[model samples]
Target: MIAVRISIVLLLLATLFGSSLYWLIGQFPGFVVISLGTTALQFTLWTGVLAVLALWLLFRILLSLIRALVLPGLHLSRNWQAKKQHKNSQLTYRGLLDLAEGRWASACKLLTKTAAGSELALINYLGAAGAAAELGNEEEVNQLLALAEKADSRNELAVALTRVRLLVGKGDYEEALPMLELLHGRHPTHPYILSLLERSYRNLQQWDQLEKLLADLRANKVLGDEALRQLEISIRAQQLTALAKNLGPDMASNKQALVDLWGRTAKSLRSVPVLIAHHAALLSQLGEPVQAEKELRRAITKGWDKELLTSYGLLGGELAAQQLKTAETWFKAQPDNPDLLLALARLCQRGELWGKARDYLEAALELDSRSEIYAELAEVMGRLGEHDKSLQFYRQGLLAVTGGETQLMVRA
Candidate 1:
């Protein structure tokens, strides 16, 4: 209805314009003229107006014709682009899946092939780098990681972390440390960054550096409490090992160093039986059996650890009788503990009391017939001049090593 009304209004205006033009032609007969150096061009004003309107009509027709001719191909081009993008995306997805499934070679192939065109180009290259690392292709891993780093600087952290993790996975801790330290400088509080640094330092046995990271690790809660305790134990153990390795023939200097180390260790960590056992053993090895026996005795008195008790029996000094007494004291508390019984047997043997050692070994054997107990008992019996019984016990030791817990013998 609106269009019809507009058409009627235009027709009436055209009629009015024509009638007014007729009247204007009769009234004035006006003209427009352009003269350039005596050569003159002239036309009626109404005719000039009609010519301008005709030109505008022709231009509109040409524009519509051009659009009609080009639009189909443009649409087809866009369709082609969308299809290529979709294909590249599918390739990226499949490459990631292949990586997850451990298909290293195939994942690397697909990911690198479509990486340049893939919209997820960063992900593709990173996945390819991982696959290359798993394949043990160090050269390819470097190249792919370089490509990942260059392809997207926006994900600089992701790229650097991937590179570091790959290096660590391949046991290249020496090479990875510098990069990880650099990352730590930038992302000082980043948890994963701290974690990666921890792993790199740990794998390299860079305990001093790792020890420095412990504060950050605790602040970030990067490792659980139990794990942190274990880490401290390992570090302390390594410290002892290092001290032992670097020692010279000076007994006084060595004893002072060991004393300093223990004093510097945390009071809580001192209670860890593993480190105490290690320190005690080191003391014995360094000709400080008196100190070794004391450390073991104090630690054992606080806690009944099998390893500590065993180490207690191995110490030798003026306190051989005292050591035996200490181990025997635990017998009342851990009457059925096979390890304690073994410790008593070892302590008795160290004292040259073969009969008492045999009794301890026999008591321990009744609880658990381990190969070591059988062997120890056989030696004690031989020392007591029971050669026949010693031979039988020796045979049983070998059988126990194989599987004699359930083996039965007929009574003769």
Candidate 2:
């Protein structure tokens, strides 16, 4: 439109200037008004030519001025955009501060007013989601998160974090499971995403998913010794729980399903001790006590655990007897391991080896005195006809119980 306007003006100027020059020349064409004896027609013709050239040059100068004028207009437009963006940024910043201060209503208003193209818009979505979460408006939170997810997916760092958080917040662990798996499959050492995925799966009781994520973390050295130890303990607890829950009398029907699930979980865990224990525990529960015994023994040889003793005792018969022997050996190997001593005490009491059981129970109490252990020991002593010792143990157990119950009440 501007080009057309300029072109039309240039054409009009050329026509008017040419007409004026021609009129000037034609008006005095017959007069001999030459300063150096030049004919009037010659002077008129030269003057007309000069006038035409001058007008053309002048028109060009005007065109140049119009073009030069556009730079300031463009600069002003850019300045306006910058100011608008800065204002939006300020809005978002203030909104975030309000959110931190728990002023959800004010935060939401400020964030909503921010422009979308600014980084403020992204922060606005985050603030709005937080506000919604605080208000317990799940639907509003979901809506805001969905918007955030859509926007962040177009950005590199934001995509994984946003999607995982959204799925987790909604308790959709199964759906949230893939982002890390897909990313780690490509990048192999994305420590942060790996940790998030692992935690999400763990919370959902998806041991198989958790196992795979942990394997990646371990492979990348993202987990330190202490963290790895804690992870192993948690995994062990979960596997044992799964085995105990899934045990059924109809082995022929449920055995394969149990084996497949446990195996898959163990395989994904990079063959951890907990998975081995899980497989054994499941097999034992399924009536293959022999295989379960072997698995437990292997786990014991690799590391010590109280779970093996409890599980072995639950197996009963020769396996249970063998477990007792293993427990005793484990106790002897690591005498300071109070749980091992406790397991030995429990196994001995089951086997009617009353004297050895009493000895181990006392040793366990010495290591770490707890109400449950003392209670069990007192019961065993009463059975052995040592009424006096049993009463003493019972009084100690009562004190421990009182303290424990008090602590629990305080926590509650």
> For each candidate, what is the lDDT?
0.85, 0.70
> What TM-score would each prediction reach against the true structure?
0.81, 0.58
Candidate 2: C-alpha lDDT = 0.70
Tens digit of lDDT per residue, candidate 1, span 1-412?
9999999999999999999989987887778898999899999886777788999999999999999999988999999999999998888888899999999999999999999998778889999999988899989988988898888889999999998888787788888889999999998989988988888888788887888899899999999999998898898889888887889789899989988988878899988888888798888878888888888888887767877877777666667778888778778988998888998998888889888898888888878888878888888888988877777888888988887553322112
For candidate 2, report its TM-score.
0.58
Error of 1 at 271 (Å): 1.3
Choose the strongest candidate by TM-score. Answer: 1
Clashes of each: 0, 0
Query: RMSDs, each prediction?
Result: 4.3, 11.7
lDDT of 1: 0.85
Backbone clashes in candidate 2 total: 0
